[model samples]
Target: MSSAGVGCLYGVGVGPGDPELLTLKAVRVLKAAPIIFTPQATGSKDSLALMVARNYVDESRQRLIYASFVMGGTSDGVWSEAAERIAGYLLGGEDVAFLTQGDPLLYGSFMYVMVKVQAAHPTIPIEVVPGVTSITASASRAKMPLVSHGERLAVLPAMYGIDDLRDVLARNDTVVLMKVNRRAMAAVSQLEADGELSRCVFVRRATTPREQIAFSLREIAPEDIDYFSMLILSGKKGQV
Candidate 1:
């Protein structure tokens, strides 16, 4: 596709943790895009998404836009404001690339931007590049298969209550729980009570050097995990 004349909106996914796994198309787009946007959680200055995209950015030709996300504030007017900022640049006929860690559409800030930007300017051209998600990276690092044969997989944020997860766990053959912060232990307890403990595996800092994999959930407990950790449970006992 010729990325000329049109004000293109590129939702670029940087992949999970590792820099080398980035797709060639993502790299080329990052290098050629006239403007790049990296969003930071309001208070933080350095953005992990930008750090990964920096490996391919052509500093001479591209301008970086730092779009900050409100941390504690209500989402009342934030979306419209962010959309306006991005629209301002895009309307100027600039190819703007929004850098996001992992797939842009998967639980990412890029989704928010894409929704609002498109709502504000329907004619703007938007392009999305898929990146290796943490679920895949974590599963690979743990040397575990996410799905096999006719098994189904379900992904839930740990932010969902233990009761919600219990229902999902009972139904899905394979479950991937992301954003398992401090509630790790509680989730583990519930899973263990359901007699699914042995089927569980926990991966911390997936695909990175600090990665950790544990087959026994009881041994490590939830308190030891960081915010970046993910928990996977396979329905069949011997599968993982």
Candidate 2:
């Protein structure tokens, strides 16, 4: 729990889709926070991060704040507005926690809010608690090693065009493609063209109830994948 005199801001990663995967520190801070903020995608009723951490949240004691973040667009204004709302709580000397899925620093929207909050309130105490990333979770559930001794691993978002993905596939021993929603088939096609589809495994919503794994690209249709889907590509074939 934070001290009484000054309020603190905590950026907490609730881990990837699994409540049990949350760190002890994340639980502690979330419990202690008087106000909790979770990012809700525009048009979404609930935030995924909040859902992952709901078991640890005491709604009666903690005030829940939902901040709207528009996905796949310029979110500077959204982040700024969220920061402003959090700034008000900090000024009132209330400890606030912002919950995010996966690690706060890794492709999480919390980073955007963090920067803006820091810029607005430089003296406010802030801490970031790290959690298990989806990449590692997907790899673990698939029973595949992301990289071996001397093997290089590359992590990329599928939005980085097919040409760039092809170049990286040519250079790296292992690659993890994240944010693979509608682009799943395109990625599968690219891997197949490179003769690497056999070594690729597709995982969706790792560690969650809706978790799905496809060892062969043929088993995965683009329509079946969600925004949380990821593909782990290995240089060797028949690994899965």
Candidate 3:
């Protein structure tokens, strides 16, 4: 994509908290981009995506921007503000690479920024460097393949009611529940009711130094669940 008098906006995925899991393309972009934007919670100072790519960034030569967002919905205004802030740098002809924890298009904060920026600046150069997502990482950590040949898969947030998740489970061969931290116990109860407890496993921060795993869902308590954790349920026997 060619654009006159504007810098490119890159949606870069750093991948599930593991520095080593970062793709060569992600590292290349991080190093080459003059402006790097990371997302953080309103009151938080850390961004997992930035932490994952910190080694590749030269602080003295690059400018780092943190776009804060309210975790659960209600972040529209903030997204717009962030887009404007990024646009300032783009207008100055500095390439901006916004870092996301996983694939930018999949549940990443970058997705929100991407939409706003694209809507506001239709002619701006935009590129996305996809990286590993927690869904597949959780599956691999548990030795569970998300799907085989013809199997269908569904990825849903556990924060929603079980009735919603149950409906998806009924149709898909593999069900991946993201954000299982908030509803860990509820999810376990629903899985038990559906006779799917044994087929599920919990994986936290897959491939990271602080990664945690539980082959049995009951072993983990909702209170102890991490925000980055997930539950991967494979309907049939296919684990290693």
Candidate 4:
């Protein structure tokens, strides 16, 4: 396709599970784009990102593209494939928007696709729109302050293991743990051992229909944890 016919690409963050949390710029871009792309997990019925963005996008006027991207899988092929599919639309001069569940740069699959697409088509224009992250949403839903003045904040993925979790907990005034699915109990155990369980708050699927908020880790069952769950540990306690 000719360079003149190529369209711009937008990486839009739909926000943490809430459609209303979507930024105005994100909605504007979604409305203007001719095509929308969202990532779906393998064997999933629908894309969560797309579900969050459905209210803003005009489905009848825009074409939807669902790309399969498995979580915790060690492979770059899926990202490359998704990029190529999006490139096809861009080559035809159709502006494309790729929706992500949270901030596109924070533990999101959009970064992988963005890198691949940009590497292959350096000249194509691209933009990234930030959104409300799960950390902030969880804090808000739990009615807790993530940090106060002069407090250090550290965000870590639970997959990094318990040792790192302990270290961060000791040093940071506020620690946000993300992707704590199967590791929920392990994380809880560590916090309990350190005498920090009382300061911990757990939130699952924040701001969504399935949302669950726990003031204490003990209040949540291991089976209740989901991939979208997050844990917040503050050195000081807040109203629960």
Candidate 3 TM-score over all chains jointly: 0.91
Best by TM-score: 2
Over the stretch 1-240, how does candidate 3's per-residue lDDT look in tens digits?
A: 135768999999998877888999999999999899998887777877888999999999999988777775578888899999998888888899999988999998888888999998887889999989988877777788787899898887764666665566667887787776555457555666667544777888788887888877667766557668787765433322
TM-score of each: 0.87, 0.91, 0.91, 0.90
In the predicted model 4, the residue pairs found to clash are: none
Q: Which ranges in model 1 have alpha carbons more than 4 Å from their true place?
A: 1-4, 70-76, 159-163, 219-223, 235-240
Q: Please say which candidate is ahead in TM-score: 1 or 2.
A: 2
Descending-lDDT candidate ranking: 2, 4, 3, 1
RMSD of each: 3.2, 2.9, 3.2, 3.5
Candidate 4 local accuracy as lDDT? 0.83
Model 4 CA deviation exceeding 4 Å by range: 1-4, 159-161, 235-240
lDDT of 2: 0.84
Q: List the lowest-lDDT window of 10 residues for candidate 2.
A: 231-240
Model 3 CA deviation exceeding 4 Å by range: 1-3, 235-240
Residue pairs with backbone overlap in model 3? none
Error of 3 at 143 (Å): 1.3
lDDT of 1 by residue, 1-240 (tens): 235555888999998878898899999989888888887777786877887777888778778878676643445366567678888878887778899888999987788889888887888888999988999989898888887898789987774476666667667787888877666557666667667544788888777677788887766754668767888875534322
